[model samples]
Target: MSKEQGRTWDTSLFKRVFSFTKPYGGLLAIILTIITVLAILGPLRIALIDHMVHHFIEAKDLAGLRTFALIIVGILLGETFLNFATTYLSQKLGQSIVKDLRNQLFSHITKLRLKFFDKNPIGMLVTRAVSDMETVAQIFSQGFLSIIGDILVLVFALTMMFVINWQLAFIVLIPIPLLIIATNIFKKAIKKSFQDVRKEVSALNTFVQERITGMALVKVFGRSKREAKTFSEINNRHKKANIRSIWAYSIFFPVVEILSGLSLGLLILYTLSRVDDPGVNFGELAGQLTAFIMFINMIYRPIRMLADKFNTLQMGLVGAERVFKILDTDELIPNTGKVIKHDFKGGLSFKNVWFAYNNEDYVLKNLNFEVEAGETVAFVGATGAGKTSIINLLGRFYEFQKGSIEIDGEDIRDIELNLLRDNISVVLQDVFLYSGSIYDNVTLGNPEISKEQVVEAAKLVGAHEFIDRLPDGYDFNVKERGGLLSVGQRQLIAFIRAYVYQPKILILDEATSSIDSESEMLIQNAIDKLTKGRTSIVIAHRLSTIKNANKIIVLEKGEIIEMGSHAELLQQEDGAYRKLYETQFDGHEV
Candidate 1:
């Protein structure tokens, strides 16, 4: 478990959380009314019992006793109904708020720039969207409104106690100060425990998610035991944190019971002392004593629950603090451009562009390049030579720190974000396919592309043969991350997917590097057909792959070293592209 921070109640944070309840204001009002009624009913029930003892039971009037019994039962039934309504309505309100909050959080996450995702772990985000959201819901179902009802019960119970017998009320409250001190200690200790538990939960989730996703790597490296040891350590810390909270509850609840027992003992002792008084009316005194006993229970129960409820509220506020932090983040890419264009000529240019994933560490420094409409340009470089970064910039996944990128003579930043991306299709080396039918993966749930369109695209890309051979044809499930398909097959599906979109610009980033020679030939043929009239950018490690490119640009250390047709670059014996080609081809004829 991590070291716990000092937790203090922020009233402003509480108010912010309360704001989610605005949409269900009417239901909340009804719940509040029900709570108020419930509070009064507890005290009123005790008074009625006292009345029956004094008037009916003492007089032995059977008819009066029956009538009073029926009235008391009726009140109990009404109270029960009110309690049920409060529970149902409060939970309904909580779930509704959670639905809205989850939707907003997910939508906000989608709008955040790719840079934000680079810094945040997916598992931690899952915790925020899943577990922490449920915690916020409890703010309504079990924390906020419930605390209010407990307080009201306390207030009403104390008032009735004073009304019935002020002296006895004072005697019973004598142990309350000690209870308060104990409760304060428990609350502080438990708050720290809750914080520690929450942290460990996130850590555990992150560890498990990462390990499971990379389980193949772990097994191949024979690190299962080592990973298990690490997981055990994290799980143990989570268990220890929970145990500490449980220990606090164990000590605190017994302490509450002891204090309550002490109050009852004092009440009994005081009544016994007054029994011998000559002027005391024994029946009336008996009735008051009975009412006082019931009132003591009413006061102490909510008092005990108040401590727990207050902690629930505190936990919820802590969750809200974390959630609101995400909501308040200004990392979203501003899509303020009003220009929406469907037809793109795909003339692209980069003018003195500078970019860095981190501050001042330029990955693409002062880069300048241009590709006229319908021309296919290739970027040939070693790993980290800023090949992928250019694609990311074109799609506006990450904003460049300086200079401008334009599409068809207009700054891409001024073009509507969706429209800008919609006109481009990229086939990455690592194709990600959702767990669904092949057809679904191809269309990406786009209703505009019909089954006939998907089939046609698959055929055009030569992916139709393999897809047709599958047991379910186009309906075959790829399982998680396309695990059911070979790397080449997944790449073919990616080609089909891109082709179906009919984008104005196409990008192939090492798309054929991992595939077999046969698959590469198929993909190459598909690429030739797809890039016919569209402006295309190709990033490749295989020199032969881009031999036919209209322009081949060689990059080293974020700076372009050479640019020309493959044959022209080959003519320069010492040029970067020529040297790279020689290394790959190794004296083989071009």
Candidate 2:
């Protein structure tokens, strides 16, 4: 068993996992049958050796020996067939389970609210989805099945031994209890070592991921040596964990092998002595001893295999517990309703909303504003002025407390999540690109988009010029968050993505800050066309970006301090907008 963590695997977890196997039930049954046949054949093959040596060898008849040889050959062939069947079916089932787990974990993770991610490390979450799931799958395939097989076969072997010679059986059984105790002790030690190793594995994965993701930052700061040292420390930790596990295994295997070997030797010696007590023929006694030794050896494999499986299952359970911890986290923002499909007529209103991240530290206080359909509104403020928080609430990324935000006359929360989100889109401050062709990256999952539309949108934001210059143009792969593209180019493509969606409510949260001045001019034109007849909210510090807005609202600590046209706000000699204009925009044009 894994040490008590905050979460542990409920036995019911297995039932939940097996629920995926309903479709593969027929294959599972066949696999189990093969395992049973293999188990039976293993002991029977040992028993056959006794019959052959005792009866046929003494007759000095070549025909009889040939008959036994044929039986042995047939058993070998049958075992081989059964082994092949088990391996293939087990692989199929394991892969199926892993695929289901990966998809389920991914879907569930995406459904979870942002707060869950805020508290949990992404490295740990990723470990659960990929590495941990693999571990559980191995347990389900080999650990789970072989444990049952080992127990059943061990029982059968003992029953046969007792029937053959009860006294000799007692000698072999003496070491069985000690072996069980040793296995348990080693398992505990191994579990601790594995838990440490598993944690280190997650740490290494996280470090590597973050390092690669932020390679530019590291290179800019010339922190390569420091980063390499940090990685070496985690790598050493992982190595130490593995070494400890190897030690436990080293100790455990030798003990099991010695005990099983001792049992075999003792049985052979005792059986030879038994010949003097009865009319047991010397050949028959030798045959029984040989059979007993072979059976002991055969049985040791299952015993050792079971112990190994148990160790692996424990590690997998630890992983599952970690995964379930993420799955079980309270969805900080719950969307409760069928997906609504009502299109917004581009109206937006906030009713005296009071909001906070947690229980305290209110970011937004009693505040209100409304924008008419097809209106463009701009929000300008310094960092931590609650500009982005409002955007997040508008998109339902987080829920606001103490107020109602309405879209098209209905409360946003009352609208079905799908319906609400479908009517709205946000081009966030951070531009993220996936590893795919530029066209694929631009269109995202919107399959209805045509190549012409993708190119049109790209052209709208000046992304097409450089894209066409690339070796494969729109077909060029982005390669991991557009690492191959300039940041300004990536931002332009992201803008095009937001425009292509043609949302009723569009929120640009500092979406164009990374773009060059020339591209910004192109994006401004694209924004004009895109925001036509839609509710558009722009958050920006650059005066150049918001000059065309119908109203510019200046926020101070989540409260609207000034709301009016750009000209009116600029005219306010003592307004917060003028102060921001002086400090941030300075000589830049409005």
Give the winner by lDDT. Answer: 1
lDDT at 225, model 2: 100
Candidate RMSDs in Å, in order, are 1.7, 2.2
What would you estimate as the lDDT of candidate 2?
0.81
* Candidate 2 off by > 4 Å: 1-10, 275-278, 584-590
Residues 1-590, candidate 1: write the lDDT tens digits: 33225646788988888888898899889999999999999899888888888888888989998998898999999999999999999899888998898898999999899999899999999999888888888888999899899999999888988898899899999999999999889988888888889889999999999999999999999999999999999999999999999999999999999999999999999999999999987777788889889888888888888778788878878887888888988897779777885468989999999999899999999989899999999999989999999999999999899999999888889999999888999999999999999999999999999999999988998989999999999999999999999999999999899988989999999999998999889998998888999999999999888888999999888989889898999999788887787788896955
Q: For model 2, how does the per-residue alpha-carbon lDDT over 340-439 read when each residue is reduced to its tens digit?
A: 6675688989999978989878898876999999999999888888998898888788878888998878888888777787778787767889999988
Error of 1 at 63 (Å): 1.5
Q: lDDT values of the candidates?
A: 0.90, 0.81
Reference-based TM-score of each model: 0.97, 0.95
Give the residue spans of candidate 1 off by over 4 A: 1-4
Candidate 2: worst-modelled 10 consecutive residues by lDDT: 1-10
Clashing pairs in 1: none
Cα displacement (Å) at residue 453, model 2: 1.4
